[model samples]
Target chain A: MNKHLTVALDAMGGDEAPAIVVHGAEIARERFPEARFLFFGRESEIKPLLDASPALAQVSTLIHTDDVVSSEDKPARALRRGRKSSMALAIEAVKAGDADVAVSAGNTGALMALAKFILRTLPSIDRPALASLLPTYKGECVMLDLGANVECDASNLVEFSVMGAAFARTVLGLQRPKLSLLNIGVEELKGNEEVKEAAEILRNSDLPLEFAGFIEGDMIGAGSADVVVTDGFTGNVALKTAEGTARLIGSLVRDAFQSSTRAKLGYLMARRGLDGLRSHLDPNNHNGAVMLGLNGLVVKSHGGASISGFATAIGVAIDMARHNLIHLITQDLGGVFMGQSVEDEAPLSNPDKEASSR
Target chain B: MNKHLTVALDAMGGDEAPAIVVHGAEIARERFPEARFLFFGRESEIKPLLDASPALAQVSTLIHTDDVVSSEDKPARALRRGRKSSMALAIEAVKAGDADVAVSAGNTGALMALAKFILRTLPSIDRPALASLLPTYKGECVMLDLGANVECDASNLVEFSVMGAAFARTVLGLQRPKLSLLNIGVEELKGNEEVKEAAEILRNSDLPLEFAGFIEGDMIGAGSADVVVTDGFTGNVALKTAEGTARLIGSLVRDAFQSSTRAKLGYLMARRGLDGLRSHLDPNNHNGAVMLGLNGLVVKSHGGASISGFATAIGVAIDMARHNLIHLITQDLGGVFMGQSVEDEAPLSNPDKEASSR
Candidate 1:
């Protein structure tokens, strides 16, 4: 029996695809000698990296797919029309029991739409949300629904709070993560009706979550909450604003270092501290977008990501798989069903059927 | 001949209150010996700062005002019943021809309402707006309607653009200030209906504003626009978020410094750079809130300001007075009414009549 960890890698995706995707698979095979990659893209594009993999030197079974997904393709339409797209085929690898997880850097919307159509959301989840870890002053904080679902209802936000809390615990190893509803203000009735209602629901919820009050964009980096949930519009804006601000601040620091001769010397002497700041603010250390709440594991890397960035994302998927995070989330969602009947329980996709079928 | 430059300061306003207010008045008096300030509050509270000010040894006429407005007081209610409040009386001092400027660190809404009600807005301006200078990565950006009006029409935003442009020229010395309407996205038709329509109006307007297009919240600090205009709610949230972010970032740096001995030494070495940042982000230096579209001068300090903060706001008032900023703004506003009839061109205020009355 081969002790292999197989990953279905979407080769024809992202800003620099086939190259970085195949390169990342090659790097991972080096770490896990028994690891196998089922590359999903055209043979002409991925043949170089596939041929370079020592284990696949003479193996015809190594490259499992030869399809490509175009980023410009409309998500829902692409899912229906492009059944053999690289992303679609990669996702199918999980369904066919040929891969432990599927990974992509393709159009996020297409991935999410196709994933839902192919894999099907767990029993209780209406939609699979994207969860990403943010670098906070206190280690890290997890935020969800990054840009998955823009228009959200109060119940959706409440469900996000539950899902995000579970994610932080599984990923960051935090116990009973502090959760907050992201809003412009902290008052109970501060936001739109949905948000205000969500606040009320969270307050009354006994989901084992530390119901921290509303966390503003500024307090996001200050450890106000271990987990934060908001509609995709606000969350995406906040995330991009934070990213843009960090870059702006980093650039400003560089300018300040060269502003005056004295300041330059001052910065030189304090190079260690400044370097620490630069490291702290760098997004690479905290890079990769995680798409959670799906039936199977999937991670989205940045379009301009390098092989190393893809490797980090692959590592995240491996860790998430090792812990059976999505399944664990299904089980832990018990907290949210405390007073509710079976009908009110959030849906969960059973992984046991997937395992037995595999 | 007495060169009494009467100033009515809200003595019972802000957290620091009479202490900072009195200290600032004393400093202003010492700095400009010819200037006289009539502190408005109950005589009992005003007497102590008066006793402290050697220059104000003769403190006889105190207007007998006894009320003080609290932050929790509603804006409209404060404007109504606060007729006897210290801030109300302070503005009344100007209306009564006993003061040149009225400054307060009370509730911003109440200040704008009272300021507009008492001193009146400049002709052709329907609503008065609060403007503040924000620190941009490249330079300074001035924004209007910080919290004065929650909902603004396209015309109001346009007027804000004109007033802000004049303000940047006079206060920041920017010749042709670039103006941007804050929006959800950069596209002309992307933002809210108001913003989309505002962009159209601005694109077609004859105002001398260098309408640079829509700007997001993140770019506000990048000097993307020399002047930014938005509804009060979003603008206030952005302002507060920026202030809070700076504070949060500073705290994070302080903690990073104490993390290890190496970090401590690095921090000590970088103390100068850090200090530069501290001063750079200081709200004190960036204090003074401009009540634009006003006939005379009204400056509202942050409700949480210290004595030095109140003093800084008064300094802005003094500068505006010296520069005849209101008259200049009214004169320059001719651009907005360029092709209007001769009767429409209004002189800001007849200097000869003003002097004779004085």
Candidate 2:
């Protein structure tokens, strides 16, 4: 058995709510036998689901919370009114050092707001950006600031690069990850001032990262870098567009195979190969968005994710906590900050600052 | 036969040079029997290719030029020193009323700089944006500012929406195309200041375009809107990411089919369906990117595009010329401008003005 790592869960969050949340925890518990869980939500709803999974019930403690934050609630309103809500309480467990990490399948804006407010950011970190694992031709790559900050300046981008590198090292297990700035073109003269400036800084930085220079969006799926950094606006759009394209192609492929009787028979013959392809591209297999630069580790799973997907998200949080991701990130950021003591002070109201309020 | 439309070709541009340009024009000649061509390049190189196609030679005039803008040349350098280059002459042909449109497969930055200098912007237009046809669930949609201007304000986005609508009407043959601002989220509170402002303006505009409100990037391939508008940086990233995702899936599908003998046999049986999918996703089928908001039409073909791809680009130019796209764009802008006369005077130098110089 391994060291016990407690994970706080927002039981009332997500589309499926306490049912999938408790069932996913059961699946996770079987995978990680030493892990313990704290389920926060209405006891009446969660007790029944938790009771169904005796294995998870054995290692879990139920904490009742009547208040639940709706998906439609704004971040600011959620922060003000959701102090004792299920989502807030889970994050508070991490803040109080009662849990190693917090995992939620809830509203993204509400989760971010509560986590930031309760846990606060690291001393050297200005803002926390969302980082997630993306499958690529080579294997997997990490992309940051997915939708956390809309308009990032050069410094904010530089910070994202630092945080992204740390997250890649912890999650992807790369000793020296190559980082690249996302832009329209690879040329130094291309893109806006912020992209160009961030490129220059990364190119000359004294950090341990291998700066791969500017990489266009097309190069992302090619696995040109271990870490891809961009402002939240562009990163979010690129990420979503890729997902939409994948879905479109998947549906089109299915339609083609079902178009005729011969095609259907062919699909049956190729079922094994198709299964492999599906397993490789399945969203449930890779389902976690790590909130980096925070004092404690917090993972936001997709609200509409199935039990399997939620389990995968818990797996991600377990890995991050085991590897001490928060400590590693803080150390990396401290080194970068010390190396650039001569530069101007970090901006108080950077891109991510506006994101919380918006 | 349709009315004869003259198209000036930059014979020295593209990876394949005069060979692909001359050959593609021949293919276009077969499709559009009334089209005339003006080939600008070295007389020695282009003469042989032109002679090889007796039909294209019959309706074509070869204009010799010693200077050829290299693909490596920067936009500013190209603009200053490529006055007599093949690319420059092609745009000049349109400005001189010798050709209805110009088409090239050259350095994008160089083409934009030279075309903007030679053709100039329309009286009501502040900048020219690159608009192209993207395949979606519902046929195809038009996306603008692929890489023309980076940092767009609300005004720039509004102008892009107008231009995109006009382009869709002319090229996609839509009566009242549904337009939407490309954003991180569909909510009014999502994204940055510029996106919110643009959505507000588009929602209240008196133009004929159907303002479909905000659309997230993931909704792009779902055919949610006929025209998607955004700043150059985000649009460029999203477009390229979609292309990359398509390529990734294509390679993965091939790998899956080749993994086993049964899969290979299945692929053979499903050849008819696979072929349909192949033809649908072929880049050559959707080739040209029209530079809109300029006084004259200029289409940019992919640098590494095949002969068929180049032909598709020529077809796009011919369509734009036949429909008088420039006039329709001017009329659309006039409507939006008249409607917003009560607001502050339009800035002389918007985001695109800085892009040209940078």
DockQ of each: 0.14, 0.58
Question: Poorest 10 consecutive residues of model 2 chain A by lDDT?
Answer: A349-358
Put down candidate 1 lDDT per residue, A120-211, tens digits, no spaces: 76656666677888777777889877666645788878878878988888988888899988764564534456767888888887777789
Q: What TM-score should be assigned to candidate 1?
A: 0.76
* Candidate 1: tens digits of C-alpha lDDT, residues B198-297: 7888898777668899886667777789998886655665666566556656666666567667666655655676677667667777788888887778
Q: Show pairs that collide, candidate 1.
A: A122-A349, A123-A347, A123-A348, A123-A349, A124-A346, A124-A347, A124-A348, B20-B307
lDDT by residue for model 2 over B246-328, one digit each (tens)? 88888888888999999998988887997888777777888888999788999999887899999999999999999999998
Predictions: Cα RMSD each: 8.2, 2.7
Per-residue alpha-carbon lDDT of candidate 2 for residues A44-119, written as tens digits (9 for 90 to 100): 9999887887878999999999999887777777878999999999999999999999999887777887888888
Error of 2 at B203 (Å): 1.4
Off by over 4 Å in 2: A342-353, A356-358, B342-358
